[model samples]
Target: MSDDGQDLAEAQRAHWQSAYGDHPGMYGRQPSAPAVHAAAVFRAAGVRDVLELGAGHGRDTLYFAREGFTVQATDFSATGLKQLRAGARQQGVAGRVTTVVHDVRAPLPLPDASVDAVFAHMLLCMALSTEEIHAAVGEVRRVLRSGGIFVYTVRHTGDAHYGAGIPHGDDIFEHGGFAVHFFGRAMVDALADGWRLDEVQPFEEGDLPRRLWRVTQTLPRERA
Candidate 1:
């Protein structure tokens, strides 16, 4: 990462921490549309455990737990994870949900092929550079079992916010204190190189109605 990238990362982390601290459940207590879709996908694939990246406040994590899948949720903001834990207890699903303060730039704190499925909603589109995004996806791949499913969503280049902010280069733009790396179709295809690219459905979210793609990909099963 360039010096600018490193500085942006630190600033984003601090911004998230403060945001969660001030707003608590800033995103409200509902699972995202992608999470709802992913839960069905995981269930159909017979997934028993799920690892959720960038699971802010864990609305989706708890939903996965309530749906009977054990969940491990991670986010860079400890404050957000704190809220998630409290919500889990309140929902009486604490036994099935675990929270970790993790940055996607680092390796996942799990053994290889340890998780049945992985879900990351709008995480890949953070302030991450293109290389870092690939690395983060690599970490996701490393943690997933063979034939595991990976469902993630990202704001795309067509989003209204894509080119409307302080340009940090590498498709990253900072707006309203949030830095986003809007993804392009080619980058998405490149990331799915070794995996089976299952589906990429366009969707919209929030009042900004952030334009995104809900991508579903799977690994090949291990040979006998």
Candidate 2:
């Protein structure tokens, strides 16, 4: 990792450690709906090896492991990893899951074309800049095997600018003193250059009426 990348990782680790260190159910105990749906898509695509980035608390990691996939999960937070380990033992899938402390701002430790499926939930939005998003997307494309699947979810960029259900301008939104970038269809298409778009849908959270986009893409057999 570069010096800048290392610094960024350390910063991210500190942020998550402070944010979710005390909350056992940080996001939730159960796997996210987007992740569950992505798992089904991977199963349908005949995926066996899975790599998950920003795997907070291992809800999806444990879910995939229990379903008989070799899972490698990475996060920057040691506290989050500890919680994940506990969750893995509780779920009886500790043997199937491997946890690594990693910062996505740096190069991923995995080799090229090493994973059959890659999952990133709320990862891109966590990036504070477009450059970071591009870097994250590049890494996602780099580790996925040809014809592998990439599934992710992000806050609806549109929702933040306009009202929740109304259409508005293209700008970042301020909520709870945090800046979040919602994604648009055009931005999604640009990010998925080498991947075949399988599905893109806007759906609301089960607990809230706010909408977000879920995107699934398959790596191209040949580079575009």
Candidate 3:
């Protein structure tokens, strides 16, 4: 990504920071369903080390750490990280959790093939464009070890309530006083070329239907 793109991402992060910085439990105290599901997958697969992108409030991070996984929880907001650190300390799992400030649209700071599992919840849906989503996916690919698992949830483009007749090519959605992007399966699969698709479960939250993709793949022979 260019410097201009980084600036836009930073701006978006700042917007979110301002919106939820004071409410530490804005995302929730417990992990999202996708994160809980991902934890089960990781435990079943015998994976121990986990990296979570956009780990708002460290809900999943705290859960995974308490379950004996070494977790690196990262977000772009300093306020979010401060809340996450406080949460970890309160849970007495601060040693098990490592927090970092990372913008997913940029290259990840971790060493190549370092993480055993990756989790992203409601992240892909926030990118304003397909190009940005692909860049974030590239960063996800960069930080995972071979045969690592990736479990994430995205707002499906097919939901009527959330879809709101938005054009197929349009990535942005304005609803419920929030503007975010929704992704279709095609767009997600396009960026997930090397990864083997394990599951694409369609479900609903309240009235909003969503899709969760669970995948496990080896790092391609080439580096990002």
**Candidate 3 local accuracy as lDDT?**
0.74
TM-score for model 1? 0.99
**Candidate 2: regions farther than 4 A off:** 1-13, 160-174, 177-179, 206-208, 222-224
TM-scores, all candidates, are: 0.99, 0.85, 0.85
In candidate 2, what residue range of length 10 has the lowest lDDT sum? 160-169
| Model 3 stretches astray by more than 4 angstroms | 1-11, 160-169, 206-224
24-121: candidate 1 lDDT, tens digit per residue: 99999888889999999999999999999999988899999999999999999999999999999999999999989999998899999999999999
Q: Which residue segments of model 1 deviate by more than 4 Å?
A: none
Q: lDDT of each model, Cα atoms only?
A: 0.94, 0.77, 0.74
- Return the top candidate by TM-score: 1
Give one digit per residue, the lDDT tens place, for model 3 in 100-150. Answer: 987776678899788888888777777456787777777777778777778
Q: Per-residue error at 20 for model 3, in Å?
A: 2.3
Q: Write the per-residue lDDT of candidate 2 for residues 19-106, one digit (tens) a residue.
A: 7776765777778898889888999889998999889888888888888888999988778888889988988888888999987777
- Could you tell me which residue pairs clash in candidate 1? none
